[model samples]
Target: MSNEQKQYLKKLKNTKIKILFWQILLIIIFIFLWELLVNIGVISSFIFSSPSRIFKTIIELINNNNFFIHIFITLKEVLIAFILGISLGFLIAIILYQFKLFARIIDPYLTMLNSLPKVALGPLIIIVCGANSKSIILMALLINLIVSIITIYNGFLTTPSYQLKLFKSLNASKLQILTHLVIPNSYQTIIASFKLCVAQTLVGVIMGEFLVSKQGIGYLIVYGKQVFNLNYVMTGIILLALISYLLYKLIVILEKKLLKHI
Candidate 1:
């Protein structure tokens, strides 16, 4: 590589490191301020819940042997919903891309479904799926599937028309054209959809848990609210934030690896 290119790459790396450093620093400062305010009389420790209080709550949950169980349940539900949503969405998007008439026909319906508030269906879902993990997974699917289909299908739609015509003139099969040109070019869009689906799936899972779960972080938050123990609520929120951040970082890693292979 040229010296200019090497220097550019080094500068980019340093920028990323600087951004990460600031992010961590901001979180530390926020936590320190929170603890300090709680220790003083500025903020109510009972309502706001200090960083140390949240730490103690974590220890208490660990001692009770319920912490991991809750985390495991929520993670499992999220994983299942996420995988199903993406797989089905990808397949359906391919179908829509191949059949233009079908795509046009369902376009309005998809938009309507996308705009619908999924939480409103919680009662019906609980009634049908019986207040279990099935309901949770189904809720998440409903939330994420339409979005995945729309995002990926739109990406596929952006495939170059000249390339499509060229492939057609050469008697290339639609499958060959899609595999070689469409999907490869849409990797970024698919990855973007993955990120969106991750967030949507989490929201759906939590909403389902709020409605009818016996275990999971959502249930813990609800339980804490019922008993007026805001620390547990705060702890659940913090855990969720951490989980979301980790999941997003994992997706970023996946994107890098996939792009490298491409």
Candidate 2:
């Protein structure tokens, strides 16, 4: 490769290294403050367990093989719900884009649905889905699907008119225009939507699990609360935060790849 390309790569590597270091530093600072507050008796250990206690709880759970099972259950539900929600959202967006009148008619209902709390529908989902993993996944999908559809549909609608006109002048069919123009123009927006949807889906799944299920991280949290095991609750919260952060990083990687051509 050229010298300029080598320099660019080196700079990018240095920037990433700096970012990682700062993130670690921030985490350390937060933990230090947490420990300090606990040691100073400013925070009640009963309600807010120290980070060190949480670490011990994490170790105990790991030794018992319970941590992995709970993590796997939550991850499975989140992944399934996220995929289903995104797929259905994209499909609906395409259909609505094709029929503007239908989109207009259903817009208010979509807004109302989005505004509704997914937790409120837990009982109904459990009744329909038999109080299993499917209930949690369905709740998450219900929470995330409307948001994704709105975001992606807006992206589709906002594809530059000039580009669409050019495609039309070229006698491009609807599919050709969609493939070459709509998707490329909306790529960034779709990535953002996916990132946001993933976070919301996680929240929705956890809430569903907390309300209706006997497994998963959310259930672990509830169990911890019932038994006054604040450390386990904190451990579950920390694990959820770490998983969400990792997913966000993956979304960032995807965004970079998608934006390269633009």
Candidate 3:
């Protein structure tokens, strides 16, 4: 590599380190401020709760051996929903791309479904799928599937016409063109949409749990609210945020590896 490129990469690494340091520093400051506010009577510890109390609540749950069960249940739901949603969405998008007439016919309906509030259909979903984890997974699929299809299908559609014509001139079949050009070109969009899907699926799982769940972080949040235990509510939200961040990072790693192959 050229010295200029080496220098540029070094600078970028330094910049990333600086940003990460600031992010950690900011979080520390925020948490310190929150704890201080509650300790100083600026905020109500009884209702708003403090970081210390929340931490203690988390510890209690851990000691009781209930925390991991809840986390595992929620994680399982998210994983299943995420995998199924992406797989089904990718296949459907490919099919739609292969059949232009069908795509055109379903375009409006897809948009409408994507725009609809998944929560509004919560009761119907639970009834149809039964009041269990199945319902939760189905709810997540409903929330995630349409968006995934639209994002990927649009990416596929964005393949350059010139590229298609060039392939046709070479006597390439439709599958050959798609595999060689379109799908490869759409990798960035697919990864980006997967990132969005991760978060959306989490939301869907939590919403499903809210409607009908005996366990999971979502159930903890709902139960906390019912009993006025704000610490559990805060802890649930914190855990969800942590899980989402980790999932996003995992997807980023996946993207990097896939892009390397591409």
For residues 181-220, could you state the per-residue lDDT of candidate 3 as single tens digits?
9999899999988998998999999999999999999999
Ranking 1 against 2 by TM-score, winner:
1
- Among these predictions, the greatest lDDT belongs to 1
Mark the regions of model 2 whose C-alpha exceeds 4 Å error after superposition: 1-20
Cα deviation of 128, candidate 1, in Å: 0.6
Tell me each candidate's RMSD, in Å, in order: 2.1, 2.5, 2.0
Ranking by TM-score: 3, 1, 2
Assess candidate 2 and give its TM-score to the true structure. Answer: 0.92
Distance from true position, residue 170, model 1, in Å? 1.8
Instruction: Estimate candidate 3's alpha-carbon lDDT, on a 0 to 1 scale.
Output: 0.94
Q: Put down candidate 1 lDDT per residue, 28-90, tens digits, no spaces.
A: 999999999999879999999999999999999999999999999999999999999999999
Q: State, as a TM-score between 0 and 1, how close model 1 is to the true structure.
A: 0.94
What are the per-residue Cα lDDT tens digits for candidate 2 across 88-138? Answer: 988999899889999999999999998987688888888989878988999
Q: Model 3: residues >4 Å from true position, as ranges? A: 1-13
Task: Output the lDDT of residue 235, model 2.
Answer: 85
Which of 2 and 3 is the better model by lDDT? 3
The Cα error of candidate 3 at residue 69, in Å, is 1.0
> Which of the predicted structures, 1 or 3, would earn the higher lDDT when compared with the native?
1
